[model samples]
Target: MENNIHGKVVAITGASSGIGEATAIMLAAKGAKVVLGARRKARLEALVKRIRVDGGEAICLETDIRQHNDLLRLVSLARETYGRLDVMVNNAGIARLSRIDDIRVSEWEEMIDVNLKGTLYGIAAALPVFKEQGSGHIINIISTSGIKIVPLQGVYAGTKNAIRTIAEALRQESAGLYRVTGISPGLVNTEMPDHITNEAARSAVKERAAQIGVTPHAIAGVVAYAISQPDNVDVGDIVIRPSVQD
Candidate 1:
């Protein structure tokens, strides 16, 4: 294996926008054959067109990360199209911020499903393919919220942290067979804040994001760096936040 970004087939979930979209563009620009998935079909179609127009190989599928079968299809599409799945980027996540007392049970369940179980499903879908190929990389898009627990973000942070722990465990288990990386991004300018149902929390987060959030491309560069490394080198955990983030 060349272990470079070029000519590698990378599958990305939540790729319609935000970090996933940025990562797909960056990777494809580097000569990667990117397979993108997300819930929004129109957005994904537009993105695929953009990548192809830019002279990069790309494909898109409507993937709801909450559905395990969707993840299987995403990975399968990568192999079927590109001959192999070099990397699986589980970048689909949601942040429904609320104080624990808010008792937003539905929101909590949504977070668990999309953030935690979703990552697990990506792993399950890719593991067999990775084992068969004897080489693969799993990248989980986590959040700095997990590292710095604060108000109204307990459950969201918990879900990210859960995946953080799992990524580490998977790394240890895979060892030489494959690589596992956890990317914990801080306030990034994305649509995540729009998903917050609480008006006050949403406003507050949006304000902070506007004030200090880094561009999604910043995180995409970090992902590119991780994937560009030699197979023997595993980039374990990365914490990317605005310099002024506290």
Candidate 2:
């Protein structure tokens, strides 16, 4: 019933840039109080300053999602500052692409830690809060890489798809008090590609993204739309890709 976003408190992880930052701004513009978490303190602070200047309510916390404790601290901020949290957006993600032959076990571990375990940490922090609140929403930022099987993106895709399954299982267990949504975006324009170490693969993906990657704001629009729907309506899975993408 509280589908209206006005006055609701939303906590977002990885809010320094890309989809997380875009969602925070969009939600705030629509009247939601936003709490942002990311490792980049300067960027988070700047975004907060901008939000405040726009007459929006926002707070920034320096957080690294790799640590479960950081995620706990993030939700604690929402409750301490806003009295309650209505939504949690798990948007922190890292994609380091390499071929299986490269055997970049460390990079593989990094992806699992940030993309998969990071999301689980968000759930661990937010689920109890959601249950206590009686109504809350969890929006997870996955990727279309999971939906499309491609070389070099294997581990990245695995992490994303793992979260997708998590979202679905979480939804089934909600039992009417909570909402879990997985948003899959294809080739987004962001700094994620910077993490790729393989020169050829990095350049290839960058060129492809540059050619077809959509703005983060477009994905923000989708997030807003999903959260605005009536309580009876739950948008389970959302897939967004450029028109030119096969």
Candidate 3:
């Protein structure tokens, strides 16, 4: 844990578990006051307690990113509790992977709502504050599944690719007012795949996970590194995957 994160205020979506949880702990350990956002209140509360016991500052705002107002509350919590928001990590997402032929329209809709639109809502919540502050970071947790598209993962990849594209465009327009980054992680171990509706796809992903997946902490480190950079430096895109993922 570096002092680079000290005194900063970080709000993270999907803070209950996986990459989001890992980032919250890591950032808080480094002295950032973290605001946890997720639908799981118990989990968020537990993490807040853990951080506080470790001499770190933290607060939890139960959030479901599908709701725009929930995201607003999350942003407000960070500012109200810590007085400022230095970073908003759009780490909330769902991957209901399945073939287009399966016609899992409901799952597809959920993915779009949670992964793509949810991320947009996070941006909406934090953008104005970032603009007013004239200095802030928006870190989106994308995926490598989008980079090398495979069957059954089409829609999930599409959602991630959409965010990747959005991050790039945001960076170009931000100028000196803000920094935008897309963190594309590959096959890190987490509970993210529990939403998969297709039995075969779920089994395949589980098998792959048992094979070479890394810890979510690796991606958290990347998020920290991106935010730790100097004001003059902008880390636009970071793709982190297991060495044997291919």
Q: Residues 1-246, candidate 3, lDDT per residue (tens digit)?
A: 464678899999999999999999999988899999999999999999999999999999889999999999999988888788999999999888878898989988998999999999999999999988888999999999889999988998999999898888888999768989899999988887666778887888877877888899999999999988887788888889889888
Model 1 residue 161 CA deviation (Å) reads 0.7
Query: Which residue pairs come into collision in candidate 3?
Result: 38-63
- Which predicted model would earn the best lDDT? 1
How would you order the candidates by TM-score, starting with the best? 1, 3, 2
Q: Which parts of model 2 are misplaced by more than 4 Å? A: 1-3
TM-score of each: 0.98, 0.97, 0.97
Error at 178, model 3, angstroms: 0.5
List pairs with backbone clashes in candidate 1: none
**Superior candidate under lDDT, 2 versus 3:** 2
Model 3: lDDT to the true structure: 0.90
TM-score of candidate 1 versus the correct structure, residues matched by position: 0.98
- Residue-pair clashes per candidate, as listed? 0, 0, 1
Over the stretch 30-52, how does candidate 1's per-residue lDDT look in tens digits? 99999999999999999999999
What clash count does candidate 2 reach?
Answer: 0
lDDT of 1 at 115: 93
Clashes of 3: 1
